[model samples]
Structures are given as C-alpha cells and as structure tokens.
Target: MAAVTAMLEELRDMVPLTAEGAAGRFAVQEWTPEGKSRDGVETSWHKDGIRGWIQKFRSGAVRVSFAVWIRDVDESGCFDALDAVYEQGEQALATFLPGIEHSPLTGHLAEAELTATDKDEFIAAREWTLDERVLTAGVVQQDTDLPVMVVVALEEPAPASA
Candidate 1:
C-alpha cells in the first residue's frame, strides 16, 4: 500500500485552504447564479451555489485509486446535508471491491490449477488479475469557508509473497 500512502500525501497537498485542517485533498470548482434582489441589489447566494470537490490519485503500476466526489449546498450545517452523499459514495466504493477468492494475493492470482471439473465451474471460479494489496483509508473533517475535503490516509500493506 505504499502507493496508497504516496497518493494520500499528494492529496494532502491538494486539500483546499478552507478545510480548516480537514484536508480535502481535492480539486474544488463551485458554480452559482448571480442575480438581483427585489431592491435591485446584486447578491450571490452561498447556499444556492453548487459546490463540489473531487479527489483522485493513481500511481505508475496501480490502475485504480480511491476517489471521492462531494457536491453539496454551502451553508451552516452543510455537513448534515451531505451525510447521505458521503454514505452513498462510501457504500458504492465498498460494493465494487473484489472478493476473497478473487483477491487472495497481490497483483497476481493463484495459478489456475487444472482440475477435471466441469468447465463451467472452472471458468466461474477463475479469478481476475488485479492489485490485491488491501488498502486502508481514513477521513478527517474541517470547518472552513470554502469546500471541505476530509483527509483520506491509507495504511501500508504487508509485503507480498514471492
């Protein structure tokens, strides 16, 4: 998981300033409508603005890196408003991860032992090749005027078996 750690450090640098040490590690682009009020006074509604932050990191060999896209209304208690968004994103990532039989080792799969079993079963049980190093992650929250990005850190994986 050294790759994961390196990405986390890079993300730490990407964190937006307003995260108040929350460390977003993302790129933020906010969009909102500018309009005039009843008195013809110009104003931009912070809550009306659509704010989003995206974080992505990938290394030379590894294909996929942990990523998060957060979009929400900017206002007091916005964190409360984004609770569902965070939960949904987290759950989706969890669902896409590989299973045990498929990920027993890192980057290499167990050789397809030739067994005189049903061809269908053999094919079904076959594992897809992928980085098997388990990634561990953490998040940190912040309070700032700009979009917040929770810092995500990954734990290093054990050395792979030769």
Candidate 2:
C-alpha cells in the first residue's frame, strides 16, 4: 500500500490526479468526462488533451493510468493514437519503476500487429519483471475521440506466512 500511495504522489507530478484531500488517502470518487477529480477540481480531462487518475481497485491491487483524448480521429490516425497512449503508459510506469525506463518496452502497437479485443477496443501491453512483482504497461483504444488509457498496474505483495 505504501508503494501505491507513493506512486499516486509521483503521478501528481507527471499529470493531474484525484486530490487526496477530497478523494481520501488512496481513493477518488467517480468523475465526469469534462474533468472532475473527487477533489472538486477538474483533474480528469482537458479539452481533448491529457487526462489521468488513480483507478479504483476492488482487490488488493492499485493502478495508475493516464491518456490523451483526441476528438474526431479517423482510421488514418488510429495507430498513431494508440502509440500515443502507449507512450503515456510507458512514461507513467517509468515514474515509479526507474529501472525499466532505460529498457524500452517489448510490445509496441505501431510495430506489432493487433486485433480488436472488444467491439471497438484495441489493446496493447507489455510486462516487466520487477523483483518479486510484475509491472505492466497497457493501452486501450476507443472510437471517435480516441481515449488512450495507459495503465500501470501495481499489485500488493503477498503476505508473509503465519
């Protein structure tokens, strides 16, 4: 949990995030597309620009993600948009995990072939072996104003044996 909290702070520097004051220690209330952090400030979207937050998790896992939304994206710029999201995800992951920064991600949507994961959602991801845990950087593709959500999933370590 400490790591998660620390990352949240780190993300604040890279991009706007839910305010711990209103969102509580590590949680943020749902927000709107126009931009609204639980902190009562618009920290989510920026007129089709960069947006980010600490994703709510049910289990003992925590993840931080950020993306840039471009309105009116045609097929011509789909791949570029995907790569844009991927870039953000890679950058966010590097914020906490400095070691992986120098080592470029293995999977890249621009270079690798990918199929639609959902109706209109295309996804790309890569894994990094970080000690006893695994770090991942993923991007989700959407239609219209494409939303590139790059997720940096960080999970809580296992508890010691009793």
Candidate 3:
C-alpha cells in the first residue's frame, strides 16, 4: 500500500497529455480484478515478501501495473498523446528509483508496452510495470544475567510488664 501510494503520488503529478485541445487532465485510480472505468489512469499492484536469514528483518518487492486511457478527436494524435503519457510515466518512475517514503531497497522500470488501442474513440491504453524492494527496520536483541540476593530483618521483644 505504501508503494502504491508513492506511485500514485508520482503519476498524479504528470501532465496527462501533450496535445492541443486535449483535456490535459487526468486521474490515478487503483485497479482491481473486477473494477470499472472512470476515464483516467488505473493502477494495480502485487507484493512478494522475500525471506531472509534473520527473523526480525522484513523485505519484499512490489510490482505495479499502470493503465492510461486517453480520448482525443484525431486517432493519430491520440496515439501520440498516449506515447507522451507513457514516456512521462516511465521517466517519473525512473527518477523515483531508490523508493520514496518507504525507502525501497531497489527500484526500476520492469516493463512497458502499448497494450491496447481504439481508433473509433481515439482512446489508447498503455500498461507498464515497476519492480521495487520495500525498506524495513532493523531488529535488535539483548540478554543479561545477574546474581540474586535476599535479606532478612529481626525485631527484639520488650520484657513482660510486672
């Protein structure tokens, strides 16, 4: 979730389109297996935890896929717009290496491709994936042994009254 949030923040800052008359506006949404359309960029992510020798140390990698849909009057211009958005997104992720808030152990653009296109609606869908390792806090342990001691107190009784 942290990685997703970081990616969303990065993508949300993109210009969306690089064409005249285009909306130049976009939205970033998290995608699920059964999600509907909303007219912007949709993203889905999966994380895999990596096992280490140390039990307290935590590490994992997150793979995020992004989909962007652009609508324009000209078919060719729509493709161009999609290209621009895709390029921008790639650049953003590339610069976002080493992670964001979570301090990813490693980050890079995994794959990018023009998954789908629709000329009738002048819409294009570009999907890309980013792989990154999550940062985790270090664990510390301490042990100690000490000798035990006990003390006893005695009270003196007064002589019986005559």
Candidate 4:
C-alpha cells in the first residue's frame, strides 16, 4: 500500500496552496446551523500537525480542491481522519474550483490563489463530542455559470471510555 507520506506529498504538489495559504485561498465564513452572523473568528491550529490539504487534476481542464482537520492526531481516527479530509477536499474542488462551465476532468484555473482563512474559520465553528463533529463554511469567487462546489466536514476527537 502507498504510505500516507506519499499520498500527502502527492497532494502537496497538486495545488498552489500551502498549509498557511488555506486562510487566503478561500473566503470562508462560519455560521450557526440556524443561520446567524459568525463574525469570522477562527480557532487555533498546531504547527506540524495535519491541518489539511488541497489537490488538483488536469486533463483538458484543471480542478482545485481543499480539505482540512483542526484537531489533535489521537482523538480523530488516525487513517480514517485523513481519508475523510481528503475526500471532503476533493468534493470541495469538484464544486468550487472547476469554474461554472468546467468539469474536474475538464476544468481550468483562471489564476493561482491560496489561503488559510477558511481552515481557521472551520476550526472555530466545529463542536466536538466524541465520535463526530460538525463544521460550517462558505465559498466565494466562483465564475458564474460553472458548477463549482466547496465542502467542509469536521471530525471530533473520540471521547474516552473511562
């Protein structure tokens, strides 16, 4: 099986976003499930931890995506956590990065952009319990007419049994 490191490395070079750039790449605002003003406050993220990642695919077009997790390595499902983040990120790309008229297999990037703002916002809104966590976010700057989507999912740390 491909080691996790290799998978991460592949994703690292796939897009123009650095871990630090997640904040600026997407203008994500947090909201309550009830739909109230979130004020844009963000949560803290540990350095050297797997905050998240972004990926891109190019064929006739280019597609970009992002996925992030803001939690300690243990409480979250080690392998499962990373997998879920990756999938969520890919889904986001499928929805938001491909431009309105483009497809993942046929979309193209109009420019190079990156940010960490979205990741931080997600961390702030997340409410952890044990087996699951909830996250909220928004996407800005999509080329009208194309079908682009951004998805943000959170996984809370598992609670102790004792």
Pick the TM-score winner.
Answer: 2
Task: Tell me the lDDT of candidate 4.
Answer: 0.29
Instruction: State which candidate, 1 or 3, has the greater lDDT.
Output: 1
Q: Candidate 2, residues 82-102: lDDT per residue as tens digits?
A: 566556655644463443343
Give the residue spans of candidate 4 off by over 4 A.
1-76, 99-110, 115-162
Give candidate 3's whole-model lDDT. Answer: 0.26
Query: Lowest lDDT 10-mer window, candidate 1?
Result: 15-24
Q: State the lDDT of candidate 3 residue by residue for 1-162, as single tens digits.
A: 243334344433333211110111112232222222123322212222211110111221122222221112234446566455445534444343323323331243333443232122112222223332212121111111211111000111222346
**Candidate 3: deviation at residue 96, Å?**
2.6
Superposed by TM-score, candidate 3 places the C-alpha of residue 8 at a distance from the truth, in angstroms, of 15
Give the TM-score (vs. native) of candidate 4: 0.21
TM-score of each: 0.26, 0.37, 0.21, 0.21
Better of 1 and 2 by TM-score: 2
The TM-score between candidate 1 and the true structure equals 0.26
Among all windows of 10 consecutive residues in model 4, the one with the lowest summed lDDT is: 29-38
Candidate 4 vs. truth: CA RMSD?
19.7
Query: What is each predicted model's overall lDDT from 0 to 1?
Result: 0.30, 0.40, 0.26, 0.29
Enumerate residue pairs that collide in model 2.
none
True-structure lDDT of candidate 2? 0.40
Question: What's the TM for model 3?
Answer: 0.21
